[model samples]
Target: MNLSSSLMACLALAPLAQGARLSDRLESAHGRFLDDRRGAFTSLSDPFGVPPLAKIVLEDPRGRFSGPESWHRNVVSTVFWVGELPSENNPTPNTASAWDGNWQANFGGYDHPEKRDGFLPTGFVPALNPFYIALPYNDIGRDGRHRPEASTVIPWFWEDYRGEGISVCKDRWVAIHHEGRVCYAQWEDVGPFETDHFQYVFGKDAPRPNRNQNAGIDLSPAVRDFLGLRSGESVEWRFTHDREVPAGPWRDWSPEPGLPRR
Candidate 1:
């Protein structure tokens, strides 16, 4: 089925998706997604270039259509995710404890090393992103122990697109809205579980629960405090790019994103 068809099936299939495993749903829909992390949608292209209602396209089988798409100001994306953060162990703990020291072995959560210097602002809460969220595995993967870090930033998963989703490395901007509050954050890492859910992350497909948890998105400590988010808190977040981002507490921390960089 095409992207349109998949969306059409969403409302009807949403009920069935509850308590469903990621693999089971994919197998049932005959949906062809890139399972292994060898080569997911890591292209450094303008994800918004592809217009939703356009006619021509060129992408892989699972629908990454690569022609000239549209530039929608407000992308049709609002993910319903349980806010998760990089804590000490698997199935993230309710509150934060000490780093336990193992930063790279088990839940590896690192951000863009290139723009790492000025990533966080002065007196930034949680001190720094506490984990190493590198490639292949964005967030601390499921069933692993992670010793958190203070000077280092913990991973927060994001889309790999410019001007639409993740614009720069850890410098990408995002507006996280929960309850009545709207907080700005950087696109730092990925996955609370099931790392390769591009269809739901980038695309407008309804957000689904992870196999181990229902966490569709994870927030850094700064974001959690600003938004007053408790553990297992529900939130609605979207890719805010550069310009669309408002002038607020998060704007001054790092250099602005969106324009082509050197």
Candidate 2:
């Protein structure tokens, strides 16, 4: 069937999806998604019926889409960390983050962007959760002031804003898909390059062209390992609420105190 027919089937069978896999219900209707990750599927574009992350949004009465704020498909992703040294490929060392002046210290150690011990750094245990990522947009500006566009561009701005000091984007959980695996991570820092591309971050637009293969997001080693991703790979991702995060290795480590857990 086509996309519209598949959607109609989804709504008609919504009750059946309860306490059962939605992917299974939609499989007969759409037959487009085939991934085995948590019964979720991957797609090349939108409205190809609902992927698992979008399933959560559809189930939640409060998270209904008002615009193009669902999954960002086929985005180029790169790897980065708290103390990644400056190099030819990476001009900006991550000694300090856009929000945290002492990112390494706060994170409790060097992330060793490359070294991995099965979803974690080989040398040390991270004081915070190892699963983290960075998007290309920063809500705060270089002038140490919240950007004017942040309030309007970010969907959760009003709901998540604590004050000017805390970032609405920081530590926000995201669900990522690569191959057949889906891994969860937090938004800890910003950039593979640009930091003002909110249009692409929260709106419907492609990533701005950049040197790093137009990387739209940066993943931590833990996220990279869990997703089995190479340095530059295409993946699908979407902002997810803490309550929606599923049980996985991402929760095997500790998150900073007071942060949400699933």
Alpha-carbon lDDT, every model = 0.40, 0.78
Candidate 1, position 74, lDDT: 23
- lDDT (10s digit) by residue, model 2, range 126-202: 77778988898999887777899988888778777788856888888889989999999988888877889999888
User: What would the TM-scores of all predictions be?
Assistant: 0.39, 0.71
Judge candidate 1 at residue 260 and give its lDDT.
Answer: 17
In candidate 1, position 210 carries an lDDT of 48
TM-score of 1: 0.39
* lDDT by residue for model 1 (71-109), tens: 112212212111233443244431222222342222233
**lDDT (Cα, 0-100) at 116 in candidate 2:** 71
How many backbone clashes are present in model 1? 20
RMSD to true structure for each model, in Å:
25.1, 22.2
